[model samples]
Target: MDVGDLLGGNAWSYVGGTLLVLWALVWLYRDGLQVDAVADKYVLVTGCDSGFGNLLCKNLDVRGFHVLAACLTEKGADDLRMAAGPRLKTVLLDVSSRDSVQKALEWTTKEVGEAGLWGVVNNAGRSLPMGPSEWMKVEDFHSTLDVNMNGVIAVTMSFLPLIKKARGRIVNVASVLGRVAANGGGYCISKFAVEAFSDCLRRDIHYFGINVSIIEPGFFKTAVTSLEPLEKELQRLWEQLSPEVQASYGDKYLDKYIKVQRLIMNAICDTDISKVTGCMEHALTAAHPRARYSPGWDAKLLWIPLSYMPSCVVDMGLKLVLPRPSKSV
Candidate 1:
């Protein structure tokens, strides 16, 4: 045989063999191929007005899951109900509101029943990335903490009995920022607390055959980042600063901050959100779910590595991206 012909045929054979192996693997895991198994399982998801909550609710409903989508506003509830069929229910639930949570629980138990409850996804979270800590107010930090951390806790506690009885899973939508610190002001801190809380919950509930999973998504084309309010907030933040701080940082710093923020927003918009949703589905229905799911390229490539890196190294790396206070003359 000619040398050229032998090399070409062998290379083609390798490619063909690799494709066949991949096809076989896909066939084996066909059931696990992001197909929702939420059928007849009543799941209560908080923050369903938009973002992951809404998306998950719609996706699950389409896949035959009985989803109880809890929204904060009437409009959100209406949107969810319209988008999803009768199998998907919409209720007004504010994780920060004790009364709302109590009412929602009663409604779910009375209507959806305890036997059908399979999972609870605490996907409702707010991120206020105020660039610099100094610029962030105490109230801003506390408010974010209340909604993100305290909110998750309240929902979990309220629904713990149902989850335990059903041996269901708890999916907490934490951020890669939680696992690895970021330049974000209060968001990272809140996520860190969430991570700790979820870990403890997992341990406590394991004996009861309940699983707790945390999703650390890098970014996605969600309303949280791409909305006009975020850009308006950044502009407002810059405007509200003291003259001394404003003068010191000037337009350059503000511009850089906005640019960086936009870059992140665009990246999130560019990536497929299914990567995050796929993890959410796995966390909910997988027989052997992972304790933590890091979704997206940024989460896998950057956040995970930095999370394991030495503290000093991580700090040095962060300093380059983050803004620092100006030096005195």
Candidate 2:
């Protein structure tokens, strides 16, 4: 039907319009449901031995994605390989080390041809809540950057050529902390860098049909925020502190902080990670994927607003939530 005829002058115009829209949807859905866009395509996912990375590798493999799972240790590699089955290959990659990164690139290129690689998911990262910024050691902060920020870049660069060739996706596992920072630590800064990098990559690669998306999760029962060592260190610090400092902000303050941490951990543990997995699948599979995905309820309700607020507002809000320091010795 002609455009003018369909506009209002034709008898069957309504029926033609309906049929055209249906046909377009059918065409789009034809290729969209296969979330494993890299099915039979080489995909390298970092930190595949545990947590989100492990789950993603398994999920992708089940959906027919050929996964080159990168683990840090032999035991981790062995476990991943055992669970991943035939389609999943294991490689020991320490993303923080240049030598390890180069080795992984060489091995990946040789094992799966440069043209065969489809996607790279930078899923390995650590979170260290090292008390206040002033209290934390420089090494604590620097090492955090070494792994979270530097490591992601190293892996991304290693596989960029292959990803470009395939016109594939890059899924970066940044945190809600990346977007909002009430909690001051090295981890937050590293995640912020990751988010920035991912955004830059998405813009730069838009013309090339390559997608770069960041997953900003609030808390997902990951090992990054384990409280065991935290508790121990806090106790040790309490013992070492001078009486004046102890009297000024007594055990009550520390107790409150620990309580908050516990509450957060509990909330994270209760979250259903399937929500995140679903988001990851969408990023890899959707014809028109979003630039960023927030995978948890807390991420949406809490961090999203915090992310947009001014620094002073965020600081005030954080102070309100944090338990007041105790004055009793």
Candidate 3:
């Protein structure tokens, strides 16, 4: 047979084979192991004031788990209490503070009693002053790291004994930024640290039957990704820069950056955050949970693939899309 005939005839075969493989993988993934006595399980979720933490607490409560929803403020706790059922309890927790984490641990220990904790969801995070690296102060990076990275470690370490006793799950809320360094700031660095920490923890505790799952979600309409707040923060950071620095990145650059940010948020951010919380739910309840879950179409299709691409290729693509600084080198 000629080259053209052979190529045309085999194309269909290749496509069919790929589809069959994907179907089989999906089937296996969906057919998770059985979970027993879900009602008896106790789960702790941080940052329950809003977003995925709040929704997950409600969902797990409805599913009959004893949910301990940790909020950063009294108002948040009260609001969560009103929304969740009677069985879902709320605690005041600030993961960045050791004293707060200790108090939360004491409360959670008392609440769970001998049954122990079935899961701990580290979902508390912050993203601020997320402009170019040149505009950031050391303190800005430290502040984000304290809340996002250190907080996760403190909370996890505090709850390890309880989780180990139940041989349960640890669901760390990372980001697609963890895999891809698309943004400049502590948000991406903190997430990258979380991914590494989860991997190491998983391997270390696997022998004890403790499962570690990392959730890498793309842009979602949560308080963390709120456009108004982010824009204000960017402006504040820009204002703090020295006059020389400000002149280097002119007012026009800042304006263009804000416009681009608004456009991206409006165009790409997923309003339905349930896609992320669903992954968290499955990780906690499934008998055999996955090590990692990348929710949202953007995460699964775009960011994840881009993360694996060559650095030069990724950088070129980023340059095309990202706004150029006024005095870019």
lDDT of 2 by residue, 187-275 (tens): 88999999999989899888988989899987776666678976775565566567787677765777787788888687655346777
Query: Residue 329 of model 3: what lDDT?
Result: 92
Across 1-329, the per-residue lDDT of candidate 1 in tens digits comes to: 89999999999999999999999897557636442445657788899898788888888888788888999999999988988898888889888888988999899888666474688999988886456666766776887888899899999988889888778889998998897776556788889998999999999879988989999998777876674677677777777789888777655777777776777677655347778888888888777677999888878888888899999989998777655445425
**What TM-score does each of the candidates earn?**
0.84, 0.83, 0.92
Residue 263 lDDT in candidate 3? 86
Residue 187 miss distance in model 1 (angstroms): 1.0
Q: Give the 10-residue window scoring lowest on summed lDDT in candidate 2.
A: 31-40
Model 3 C-alpha lDDT versus the unseen true structure: 0.93
Q: State the lDDT at 229 in candidate 2.
A: 73
Quick one: best TM-score, which candidate? Answer: 3
- In candidate 3, which residue ranges exceed 4 Å CA deviation? 1-30
Runs of candidate 1 exceeding 4 Å displacement:
1-38, 114-116, 267-269, 323-329
